[model samples]
Target: MNVLIVGAGIGGLSLALMLHKRGIQCELYESARELRPLGVGINLLPHAAVELNELGMMPALAAEGVETSALHYYNMHGQKIWEEPRGLAAGYPVAQLSIHRGVLQMKLAEAVIERLGAGQLHTGMTFDSLEQDEQGITAFFIERGSGQRVSRRADVLIAADGIHSAVRRHFHGEADQLRYSGRMLWRAVTEGEPYLDGRTMFMAGHQDQKFVCYPISEPLRRQGRSLINWIAELRVPQAELPTTDWNREVPAETFARHFDDWRWNWIDIPAIIQGAKAIYEFPLVDKDPLPRWSVGRATLLGDAAHPMYPIGSNGAAQAILDARCLADRLQEAGAGAGHTALELALREYEAERLPATAGIVLRNRLNGPEQVMQIAHERAPGGFEHIHDVIPENELNAISIRYKRIAGFDPAMLARRTTP
Candidate 1:
């Protein structure tokens, strides 16, 4: 079967690799003419790390990213709310990696180019539309530089395009579907001394105002320093969403004041804000889960399928999982040159993943595992003498475990799934 994948981001590249692993032929087309190591850092949960490990890319990933050791949550006063060991430290048999998104994308793209052959992956191709009959799906793309149109036919078309996906817009229609939270995020990286174990990820404050910080560079960590990736999120009063571009740079002064008093004994939040060269502003928004993600010979994956709030650090993780799941289903269905088999396989993939990711979308709306912070804030607005006094240990543990299960990374569940 010839599979056509749109967008060379994490999901699309991962799906291509996964398909190749199963000996299935696939081609990748990305809108960006060049894939740069852009964007700040992101955390790969243990489950996602395991998937990449299965693909035999963990050594390369570990070289580029730090192996995250733990996760912690704190209230506005910098008082601890909850803490848990993560990745291998948490006994999942894999390390949760914290790597820059652009670097990871480039790594995945490099793999695609190498395994799929030098000329297999194409950039400068922007998806326009697609049409499928009983035989196969034909997709349309416009060249990025020239006014030329390129067309390709495949047994199935998988749209792994991101949040602003054109293929998705084609199906849902361009009525503006992004649901903006009142909050906006300013994300950037800072180089400084490492905090807490040199490999910890931490978030302070509640949903309205929050500061997240973590080291993301293995090379820096080895040098006894750190490259910290941080986000300063604030609730914006505007009803309309600000520019949702992930690369839109803005002044730190726009949202730095909210975190002026956010410094604590261990880490200084204000200095971290002032340290960044540029802060990219993006609205904390998500689309309402679609009624369906697959239609006939075409289907959606990754952000195209489920764009959720990045609360639990599951965006890339979920996309990797989707790629694996879809590839598995197609392999099971014996997807061939026949479009009918591919369609059935896509529907099966959708039936399982659509509902799963939709649940995460809604759960993240409620702050997911970070709900511990919300509960603590609501229960004790002034500040807590003791977090346990405000929110019980059981409640905190329960919230974390529940989110892990919902996000498909529950320890027992992963063990069962990974068991040969």
Candidate 2:
């Protein structure tokens, strides 16, 4: 069966590779003229890492990225709240990898090109629409460079087109489906000396104002150079919101004020903000879980299927999981059962993923891992001489455990699961 994939981002590329591994023919269409290294860093949790390891790309990823040992939590004043071992350090089979999103995308794309050939993965093709019949699905596209129209017929079409997916609009219609979470985020990367344990992921500040910083590359410990990625979130007062664009630049000064007092011994948070290369601003947004994602031989995947809040580092992981689940279902159901098989597979994928992701989306807004600081602030009512005096050690441990379970990273869940 010929499968057509849209967008060629992480999810699309992953699906293509998985299909090739299964000996199924597939083609990928991307809107970009050429793949450019974009975005900051992304974390690959053990659940997602397990899938990529099976693909034999873990060693390369490890070489290109940092193997994070633990996640650290702190207050705005730089007081340590809690720390926990992650990935292999946490006893999972896979290690947590933190790498630039572009690097990860390139790695996946290179694998697809190596196996599927160059022509099979077409750049400069913008998806316009799709039509499906009993026999197959025909996808319409326009040449991005020349605006020339073209069409291709495939046994199935999978839309992994991302948050503002055109295919989703075609199926669900352009309604007020996307919801703004009232929190705006500013992201930037800077060259700096390694902080903490060199590869630790750090979260600082309170819920209303928070900052997450982590290393994206293997630390040059001798040279004291590392690629640091950071995200600053603030509650905006505006009732109406702006469109979601990854390239939108935000003035660093607007968010840097919150970190002025953060004089941590390990690294200077305020200085890193002032010296950032560039800052990309985006409002935290997500869509409500849809009842279904499949219609005939056409279906949605990744951000198109379930756009969740990026708080839990599950965006890429969930997409990776979707690709594996979809491919497995398709491989089980041959040509004659394609339509029904695709629908059933999508339903099963949603059943397992929707509730889990929906809880994460809502919980991220309410009480994520950073809530530990919130409790500390409340109990102290101002400031604290010691964190333990305000909050117990056991209570903090419980909070971390709850978040792990909700995010599908708990040790118990990972031990039983075979695939992401």
Candidate 3:
């Protein structure tokens, strides 16, 4: 079956590579005139890393990104509340990757072109709408280059077009409006001395006011330099949603003042903020989970299917998982399988992933695994002499494991999953 994929972001490109590996014919339509490396840092949990490893991408990821060793949660005072070994250090088969978001996208895009060939991946094509019938699917796009509308026919259309997906807008419409969480985030990268073994990810403070820091560049780390990616988040006073653009640049002064006193012995939050050359502002927003992500031969993936708060670093990981699941289901359906079989494959993928991600969406609103940080803040707003004095050890471990299972990355779950 010939498949049409919308968007060339992480999810779409991953799906393209997965489909090609299954010997399926697919083409990608991306809105950008050309794909450019963009955005800040993101983490690839072990479950997601397993998928990438199967794609033979672990080496490339290791070369460009740091393998995150541990995750630390701290209160506003910078006292560690909880710490857990992550990725292979945590005993998973693979390592969790902390990499630049744009670099990962570019790597995935390059793989798509190499495996699927250049002509299969088309840029400057904005998805406008689509219509599905018993025969197949027809998708219309506004060709950005020529200002002309064009249509393509395929047996399936998978929309991995991200949070602002036009296909999602067409299907879900009014029901898919973004729900702002009253939190704003300032995301940027800075070069500096590495903190905490130079391969750790740490988040300090509660949900309202927090500072997250992690090293994202392995090469820089090896050179005794560090490319630290950080995010300073705050509970903004605005009730309405701010601009949702990911590339919206703003002065660090917008949120830096709140974290002014966040200096600790090991890491200096203020200096990290000041060191950033550019910081982008994004409101913490997510859409309510849809009842379903498939309509006939058309379906959604990644942020297009479920946009959640970035509480657990599960955004890109979940998208990679979606690509794997959808590719598997589609492969099982077989290329010659008629439209009815194709539709069933899409539905099967939805049935498995829809509720799974929906749970994460609602759970993230309540802080997901990050709830421990919020709990510590609630119980000890004045700070505590010991974290266990404020919260039990079992509670912290339970919170972490529960979120891992909810996000489908529990060690047991991953151990049971063999490479596809």
Candidate 4:
């Protein structure tokens, strides 16, 4: 069976790798003229790390990325709210990874190209539309530079095109709208000395205005220069969202005001903001979970299937999970039964994932893991003398546990599932 994957971003490329591992023939089409490394840092929790380990990419990833040991939260005053061990430290079999999105994409893309060969990946092919029948699925495309139309037939089509997917529009129609989160974010990466242990993922301040910073590379072990990735978010009045392009630059001064007073002992927030090489702004947004993702032989995956707010660091992780699950189901269906098998697998995948992701979407908006800091901020109104005085240890632990369950990274869940 032949599979045609749309959009060569993290999801599409990961899907290709997973399908290839199952000995399935697949081709990936990307809209860009060339596959360039893009975007900032992304976190891969233990759950997703299992998938990467299965694909034999974890060792290489570990060499290029920081292995996060814990996730720490702090109040706006720079006081530590809570810190919990993560990944192997948290007792999971896999380690959490913090790496540049481009690095992750390049690693997966290179792996796929090496295994699947150069002919399988077609760049500069813009998707126009798709038509599906009982026999197979046909996708129409245009050469991005020449504007010439092209078409390909495959047993199944997987739309992993991301938030602004054209394949999603072809199936869901034009009415699909992205919901705004009333928050705008500015993100940038700077070459800098390591902060904290150089393996910690840190979150500070409040939802209206917050700073999440982490190291994407290890400087100590290999003389590699550590890259610090930071994002500043602020609550804003509803407005049209910015284009979803990763490289769209926004001035650092626009959002730096929120962190001006963040004088923390671990790191200087304002200084980091002022020193960033470039900053890009994007409104925090997500689409409501769709009722269905499969329409005959064509189905959506990743952001195309369910675009969730990027709060729990599940954006790329969920996409990797989707690719693995779909590939497993397809492999089970065998060669001649591709269409029927893919549709059934898509349905089952949606049934299992949609509700879980919807819960995360709402939870991230309402109370994610950061709720501890929010509660601490509210109870102490003024900064606290001690964290215990603001909230009890068990209560804080409960909040973290709830979020882990919702995000599908709790120890119990991770323990039950076999790696890969």
lDDT tens digits, residue span 386-419, model 3: 9899999999999999999999999988999963
The top-ranked prediction according to lDDT is 3
Off by over 4 Å in 4: 219-225, 238-247
The 10 consecutive residues of candidate 3 with the worst lDDT sum are: 238-247
Cα displacement (angstroms), candidate 2, residue 18, comes to 1.4
Off by over 4 Å in 1: 243-246, 335-337
How many residue pairs clash in all the candidates, one count each? 0, 0, 0, 0
Task: Give the Cα-based TM-score of candidate 1 against the true structure.
Answer: 0.98
Comparing 2 and 4 on TM-score, the stronger one: 4
- List, residue by residue over 308-404, the lDDT tens digit for candidate 4: 8778798888888888888887888786675567688768777777777777777877748888878887888568998998899999899988888
Sort every candidate by TM-score, greatest first. 3, 1, 4, 2
**Cα misplacement distance, residue 347 of candidate 4 (Å):** 1.5
**lDDT of model 4, residue 262:** 91
lDDT of each: 0.90, 0.84, 0.93, 0.85
Q: Cα RMSDs of all predictions?
A: 1.2, 2.1, 1.1, 1.8
Least accurate 10 contiguous residues by lDDT in model 1:
238-247
